[model samples]
Target: MSSLELCYPQLLNWSCRGLECLHSEAVLLYTLFSSIAVITVALNLLVIISISHFRHLQTPPNLLLLALAISDLLVGLLVMPVESMRIIESCWLLGDIMCSLSFFLSFTLTSASVGIIVLISIDRIVAINYPLQYINVCVCRVCVCVCVCWGCSFLYNGLILKDNFSLRDRHCNGECIVVNNYVSEAVDIVVTFIGPCSVIIVLYTRVFTVVVSQTHSMNSHITAGTGCKVKATKSQRKAAGILGIVILVYLFTFCPYYYPSLAGENNLQVLGIVTWLLYLNSCLNQLMYVFLYPWFKKAIKFIATLKILEQNSSHANML
Candidate 1:
């Protein structure tokens, strides 16, 4: 009786309880998750500032990046803190309304991020395979694409989780769990993971194939005649490789969630750690920007030093 009372205080039948943990472990978890939340917010905010404030950085590719950065930033800002509390507590203390809203926002932001990356894959393919045609990708057109990506994400996720968003309890007490029928579960995985990932992979393959062909052609031309030059420059090829790494990192972080879905199991079963890994993609995207792009680094330096406050700062060369 005492043990039962210890495990289930108040004798409530439906309330969920978390696994017992030492106080030190709980404190350590809270600290670690808090630090991750801070880093995700700060890194994405840097990307947002770098791209938005600088005119020179306002190209089609960078515009796609800006949209991605915005999605990731919201993940850090709106999603991570609530997620951290849920993880640390291992229970939902927040009421039903908040739970549904939080999950809706989470689903929307994650889908938006994935959709932007799909657009990025296509953009990189065009840039690498057809440089002249790439310039035809106008800013207005890219803006339209971005809007479509976000709109699709909102609509798709809303349809999938429509039940949860209806201002009712999430069908659980002391738990914020997602429940889906067999068909919706399968549809969700196919649309969110398998479909987009397959497109990204195929697009990246075409890009790398073009890249290698261009590199070999350039090398042969250099051997034959010093004056001969290829359409794809050395620097552009390097940038393509670097950006490939960034996308690969995003895939590595995101693709693990597919496992539980594949196994036909509850996401909540392995969700705690997997979800955090997913959130870390938000930070890694910005960190890769800092590492790969010299212009981005310069922009960061300028902003950090407050030189951005000076007159005509936006006109300064970022590239």
Candidate 2:
């Protein structure tokens, strides 16, 4: 091999080759990836602030959203930049420990984001199907669910990637790729994608059906006592519809990323495109909220203008 082929001259053939990109193409790639990272962080940060600072926005559904925002924020702030450098440079300059930790965080945040979506689906289901009991169940139980989602994500990814931390069999100098055994890959696909997506689809289908039936029923005259119930149900339906869009976008982006695992092909070239698409989902989510929810727009205005800094601003009626 030529001297330039090796990422580390000392490692010879074992070291991965350095990437060679045309100068113009390299500049474009950096610009694209950097823009994505910035947008992801900024948008998710708006969500985090919107939910955390506003008392009216701290409802159970929004609490789940906050957790999701945090995960996405980490994806932007941590995973995207590192993964971009690793992919574009085509070599790992960082040591093995950093590589392992980066992969661990990527997997954990991804799983947590999916878990949060599942929780949101469940929350919407309960709000629609059991509107009367939603208040009782959501107030404390939903918080517990959010906590469990994050905790499980961390522990589960740790187990799945433990070997990468301890063994160097699949890696060499200047190589940051992670290798997973068949069983582990299968389990990850099932747990992170298959099972959660199935649940979300099923729940959303039911939610849509119920919403349509409810909308049809709304045409009929309603008694005064039932007016409050009707209003709440309408609000719940709207939230469900918006969340459904988010889920659809998420699945669209993530399914491609997992295709290699499903097809039993594990190669870097296949991963690079799909993984960036998956990261793009983070930016899309906030855009969806902006388009679908007026409250988010109002919140953004207040945040941008520093109106939220005022005393008692948390109590401002956002909804």
- Per TM-score, the best of the predicted structures is 2
The digit string of per-residue lDDT tens for model 1 on 1-319 reads 0111222345376566565556787789889888877888888887878888889899998999999999998998899989888776655768787888898899899999999999998888888778789878899999999999999999998898887766355354666766567888889889988899889888888877888887787777675454435544666677678768977887888877777777765656387788888888988898888888888889989988999999999899989
What lDDT is reached at residue 254 by model 1?
86
Clashes of each: 0, 0
lDDT of 1 at 311: 97
Error of 2 at 287 (Å): 1.0
Sequence-dependent TM-score of model 2: 0.93
Deviation of model 1 at 198, angstroms: 0.7
Worst 10 residues of 1 by lDDT: 1-10
Candidate 1: Cα lDDT at 194: 87
**Candidate 2 deviant stretches above 4 angstroms:** 1-3, 220-233
Badly placed stretches (over 4 Å) of model 1 are 1-14, 166-172, 223-231, 267-269
Highest lDDT: which candidate? 2
